[model samples]
Target: MLLSACSSAERGPVIPFFGAYFPSWIACSLIGVFGAVIIRLLFIKAGIDAVMPLRVIVYLFLAIAIGLLSSILLFGR
Candidate 1:
């Protein structure tokens, strides 16, 4: 049974770009980081960042959420 679970078809999704293969999650994570930076810039422009509590944690989770959502939506992973 364990052997059956190890089929080659079960390999996780990867993206091919520029003659290199990268795991889809890596792309999603980069997008998330970019999104977080843009969001922070917007927040600063609107003067909202200073009012938020635990700003680091909020941004960290925002990046993580963006990464996971993009991963699911873009790669179906």
Candidate 2:
């Protein structure tokens, strides 16, 4: 029984919408993807994308960064 008290909490956030529940991470991931798209478009408009040799990899990293950032800001645990 004492060991139970030492266990780390794993209660991640959840959102209930339209009578359904959704994990918060999923929402953050989608937000990250959207942000990545906007950043990509901005880079394209500024003519910076043309100089990047690793477009796909860079975009993937951008999405991951945004996702992690959102998780930190929203979860903060």
Which candidate number has the best lDDT? 1
For each candidate, what TM-score against the reference?
0.90, 0.84
Q: Compared with the true structure, what per-residue lDDT tens digits does model 2 show for residues 1-77?
A: 76775565845588888999899889889989999999999999999999998999999999989998998998773
Model 1 steric clash pairs: none
Please, what are the lDDT tens digits per residue for candidate 1 over residues 7-62? 98888889999999998889999999988999999999999998999999999998
How far out, in Å, is residue 32 in model 1? 0.8
Query: RMSDs, each prediction?
Result: 1.2, 2.8
Q: What does the lDDT read for residue 71 in candidate 2?
A: 89
For model 2, give the 10-residue run with minimal summed lDDT. 3-12
Q: What is the C-alpha lDDT of each candidate?
A: 0.92, 0.89
**Whole-model alpha-carbon lDDT for candidate 1:** 0.92
Q: Residue 34 of candidate 2: its Cα lDDT?
A: 95
Evaluate residue 76 in candidate 2 and report its C-alpha lDDT on the 0 to 100 scale.
76
Instruction: Provide the lDDT at 16 for model 2.
Output: 89
